[model samples]
Target: MNAYTLLPFIVLIAAMFLMTRSAKKKQQQAANMRNEMQPGSGVRTIGGMYATVKEVNEDTVLLDAGPGVDLLFAKNAIGAVLTDEEYNRIVHGIEHDLKSDAGLVPDDASSLTESDESDGSAAATADDKIDLGKKDSAEHGADAIQAAEDKAAAAEAKAEDESKKTDGDSDAK
Candidate 1:
């Protein structure tokens, strides 16, 4: 009957209203995305299957799952649509990372090699050969872990030395 009693109910109603409004906005955005689906677009399904849009129906979509594979799915099953740039990045980024990890230089950097500048010949040096394919993934991972541990140990030793110096300074003071 007073402001004190009505305050909790008012706060609860405001929270519920805000939540409903957010849900409605999300639903509208999803509807807009679905309506904008066109053929040749890349989409990932809710089941985590990546496919290309082959055709679009009122409530269903035809997807190409690569290599002459085609399947139909509900329109609502699509999770997100990818742009052309995103699709190319996903496909080629892994290859680029793998090449870099294998100790190979990019084709454009001519000063790093002497075999051929115009032909993009990557003549492997002794260091590159030693680091190339001599070890398995497990061995490489172990080496990386060991290097990190050595750096951490060095840092800890330095920190301890600084702390001891500080303590000695305080004692002298």
Candidate 2:
């Protein structure tokens, strides 16, 4: 075999190894992003759906895709998250566009008012309500309380019934 021919084969192997490594790294980065997704986060899906996260499971996420349209997708299908700054920019830009379109404010000059501030506060409050904080802890506490109460009630009922039964048996005897 010519030395030149062997050189090409070595180069091909090296290229394949590099490509594989790059793909692996990409997947790891994607996995990390998916894991970081939380409810109320803004994300765009691979399928071109953009929405705020409504729920996040180990492998899937539920999104409110506007107009009462809810969507469910694999966590891996999430394409990108809008950073806090990016999200604010987009929201403000959209608000401005909508106001301009509606002729609600003059294009020459405008200022956000007290109502706007209140509206923004309300929106943030809505977001806080949507955020599922410490779900596991809340669920566990509720379940434990419910179970303990249930067990105590059942035990008390059982004791009462047993006492009545014994009294009835003695009276009959």
TM-scores, all candidates, are: 0.57, 0.51
lDDT score, candidate 2, position 13 = 99
Candidate 1 global TM-score: 0.57
Worst 10 residues of 2 by lDDT: 106-115
Candidate number of the best lDDT: 1
**Global lDDT of each model?**
0.83, 0.78
- List ranges where model 2 is wrong by over 4 Å: 91-106, 109-173
Pairs with backbone N, CA or C atoms under 3 Å apart (clashes), candidate 1: none
Best by TM-score: 1
| Per-residue lDDT value at 129 in model 2 | 47
Off by over 4 Å in 1: 92-173
Residue range 78-102, candidate 1, lDDT tens digits? 9888887676566445343454566
Write down the RMSD of all candidates, one decimal each. Answer: 17.4, 22.8
After TM-score superposition, the amount by which residue 49's alpha carbon in candidate 1 deviates from its true location, in angstroms, is 1.1
Backbone collision count in every prediction? 0, 0
